[model samples]
Target: MRRIAGVFLAVASVLGAQPRKPIQDVRIDILSTMLTGNAGLGEWGFAAVVEADGRRILFDTGARPETVLRNAEELRIDLSGITDVILSHNHGDHTGGLLTLRRELGRRKQSAISKAYVGAGAFWQRSETSVLAAAKNAYESGGGTFTEVASAREIFPGAWLTGPVKRVHAEKNYGGTGKVRNAEGLWVEDNLPEDMSLVLETTKGLVVVAGCGHAGIVNILEQARREISKAPVHAAIGGWHLFAATDEHLDWTASKLKEFGVENFLGAHCTGIEAVYRIRQRAGLTRRTCATGAVGGGFTLKDGLRPGTLAK
Candidate 1:
């Protein structure tokens, strides 16, 4: 019986020594962005379809009503199968196609988007000019639901939402001249408090996806570190909103990326081409690792990053 016990212990030791299986491939398909090469339309907006752990989530809408819809149809990507949608913030460029997406995609499949996940203060404004305010009413009345996440939480086993990232870095990215009233009837600068990002956990590392990075990419990463894991970031894909970043700011941003160990970077939308190049130089990222994000490009675990038009 001693030999039997020893054999069992050996097996247990080996089993314990084995590494945990990595999560399945999380495929990200960019449906809207500034650049497009696959005969698809390009616009000044952000929208992507993320397939992770057998769930499909539309990250954001687009600037115009037809941009995302036309691109999706052009790319031969079906949005009808997706039931979950995440609105990164309340900006028009990010939420302009909310109604169109739901209406068009829902026509094909009634359950195209059953629920929308948004930040807590996304619809804080009641003005008629507020796109989000209009969407909230129209959306809810159409039998759809919205869940406002205020803090970091795992929406699924391997997918997490870094809700309302804490601005822990010197990156106060937003500089728009807008204001909104809070629940207490106090008006404040619309610094996009509803800004957030999606963090996906995999065996390699965490993959952070952002809409506009208006909350500051560093802030998003810090929140992910606190809520998700402190592991090296495997990839960061989406709009960086650094169109007008100064040299000093870009250098600081690059340093932060290096500090977080970001391996792959896809800078899209307001993440100016020159900014991507500068950051690449400072962060020691190669063309293959750090490339501009386009309408027909994205990243996935199985095939790695599908670089954009300006990959070179």
Candidate 2:
């Protein structure tokens, strides 16, 4: 009996010591952005279909449902397969495609999106009833539900939502010109508390996906490190919201990102082309470090070219 107990303990220890298997590959199909390699479908928004671990996830919905759907058809991406939807923020540009996505699901008579993961502040619109009303309406229309993330939580085995990143660093740049409602129902300047990021733990490191990135880029990365995972950030794709950044702000951001040792970076949507150029030129970032994010561009991180290399 003593020997058997010892053997069971050994087996338990071995099983506990084994690390979880990392995700094999992540395929990002960009549906909308500022520019397009495919003709006629371009919008000033961001949305991507992420395929990994046998799950099809929609990162954002772009600025317009029509544009996103059109691009999805052109890319031959079956919207009926998306099981999860992660909304980075509550802006119309990011949530625009919910209605259209709902419509598509209704037409197919199939359940594509099961749940939409959103931040706490997602439903808090300045003066409006609720910015998330659109999302709620769509979900109800399709027999879906909304999962509000107040803190860091993992929706999947290795996928996490860096729930509400804290702005610990310098606040030189005033996020964006958006607002949220107060508890008393008054509109106040939005600090974008609902801004969250998606972190995918992989063999190499963490692959972070941001929408708008209203919570400074550095803050988002730091939150990922502090709250979610300790692994180094291997690659980051999405908007940084540096459209109105000054030369100094841009330089500082680039230098900080370099310090963080981020190997791959792809900025788009609100990251302003001029901001990208400045980061590459003055901030000492290489073209490879400062990747392209044209519309309708699909980026396959593993089993293909690195992030931002699939620019058309």
Best candidate, lDDT:
1
What's the lDDT for residue 102 in model 1?
86
Give model 2's TM-score versus the native structure.
Answer: 0.87
Clashing pairs in 2: 35-295
* lDDT assessment of candidate 1: 0.85
Model 2: lDDT to the true structure:
0.75
Candidate 1 per-residue C-alpha lDDT over 1-312 given as tens digits, one digit per residue, 9 for 90 to 100: 999998998998887755544567788988888987665788988999998877889999988988988888888888899888899988888889888888888898887776889987888873326677777888887768999999887787778898887777768788667887776888877778888899988877999999999998888887898778888899999998888899999999999999999998989887888998999999999888888888878998776788665563
Using TM-score as the measure, which candidate wins?
Answer: 1
Enumerate clash totals for all models, in the order shown. Answer: 0, 1
TM-score each candidate: 0.90, 0.87
lDDT, candidates in the order shown: 0.85, 0.75
Worst 10 residues of 1 by lDDT: 15-24
